[model samples]
Target: MTPRRAPAERQRDPERTKAKILEAAKAEFGAKGYAAARVSDIADRAGVNKQLISYYFGGKEGLYNELTASGYRNNSAITDPATPLAEVLRQFVFVGPSDRDAARLFVWENLEDSDVGFDAQREFMQRQVEYMRARQAAGDFPDDLDPGFLLLALISTASAPFAFARVARAATGLDPTSPEFTEAYAEQMTRLVKQLAK
Candidate 1:
């Protein structure tokens, strides 16, 4: 009798496969930045064929765009009006890997002076500025302060530890990415933000 052919690999789960590709892509983009990350490497990391990336994301640019959008989507709660501003600041400090990857991606964009996704970033920040303006009008803070600048300051303060890890560690003698540092810093940031609103 003829030898039986090997069974075909089980069918892939679309959502799970996409998630695996995204997670692997995030790591690759974060470590090497968009300019240097490769589709084949991400595929290898995800244990999927490289063509799956193109099939799912349409290619590297699409993967980068989706990664950027997902970062915002994952942390969209931080901007919810129902959340107190101080709590929002705290949440920003305690955000997970997606935000960290976004921060790294931002650094790479800055280093390369690329404007790949500035419009989307600008639109997001504009909404944030509008929210801050509304908060100022509601007497959450002094109306004399520019809402745009205030929002910028708050974001920078929340993101400083991640974006400036070396300086953060040097200044505080604590690893900026550590739970100890994040917890303490989140509380301090919340207090400071509350003071601003008062």
Candidate 2:
């Protein structure tokens, strides 16, 4: 096995160290929530000194903020103007394993009644509503439908299978998180959204 790099060498690459810390923070916060997650635990998970987290991110709040911001940015891909809303619905329905942590973080926030990222999240949702309105104006959605309600329904549907995996499995007798199930669900959602547009 190759020898591990020294701490000084690891500290030399700030970007890599910050990335490791952020990744570790995501896991920790997902597993324990912001209030319960400890900075020392994140540092330990990242294999770095606890002080490094403070040095790089100022503290747990800053780390959480960065993760929340990054999550929103990453999810914005579904809002690409060129992609049809049906295809967008399909993409949102297929939440792969890599996205589980972010989903879990959302649940944790809800459970704790935390509003740490409320402003940003609300802004993001408003943008989705605006996107739906634009789609409606473009004739993709019927004028009769309320764009805000449609967005709310779409978000609920997209997040349901992941948020209630055990319920989904019990109801459908299939692993909701499995690729087969998600693919079929995604296709079904895509078809359903297409119908809404017609």
Candidate 3:
């Protein structure tokens, strides 16, 4: 086995350094929440100079926004009329629960500060609502359903398990964060969407 490299040494490459810092920031913000998270803690977790985060991201808010943007980009895709609603929801369930840390960060955003990525996320969800509206017009979904609420329900369904993974695990004795659980849950999520859209 290759010997483990020191944290500072691990960040030698600039791109690697930036990625490391983002990851560390995600974990820190996930665990401690936005109001309580500290830059020093992030820097220590990343194993880089505290100044490097400022140099790369401008400041904590910058890093947080970047994480929010990239997290949404990484998890969900923009859907069109050709995209199957069930499939889109399946992918969301698949990606959303797998990243427990991101779910935690989302909890922080919702409970502590809802302004973290409001504009961009609203724009993205608006597009989804329009797509859903088209589908409803075409009779693929219920005509009575509000498009925005449909999107919210799907998103919340996927996020709920992970946002409270620890609590669920404690209460149910099953690891909701596990790969097996996510795969099963994704199937259920897709099935539920299919039933709802019928």
> By TM-score, who's the top model here?
2
Sliding window of 10 residues with minimal summed lDDT for model 1: 96-105
Top lDDT model:
2
Model 2 residue 104 lDDT score: 81
Q: Mind giving the per-residue lDDT tens digits that candidate 3 earns over 121-160?
A: 6766777788788777766678778888887887788786
Ranking by lDDT: 2, 3, 1
lDDT of 1 at 188: 92
Q: Per-residue error at 29 for model 3, in Å?
A: 1.3
TM-score of each candidate?
0.86, 0.88, 0.82
Sort order, TM-score high to low: 2, 1, 3
Name the runs in model 2 displaced over 4 angstroms: 1-11
Residue ranges of candidate 3 with Cα displaced over 4 Å = 1-12, 78-80, 166-173
lDDT of 3 at 129: 83
Question: By the TM-score metric, which is better: model 1 or model 2?
Answer: 2
- Which whole-number lDDT from 0 to 100 does residue 93 have in model 1? 78
Model 1 misplaced regions, further than 4 Å:
1-9, 96-99, 110-113
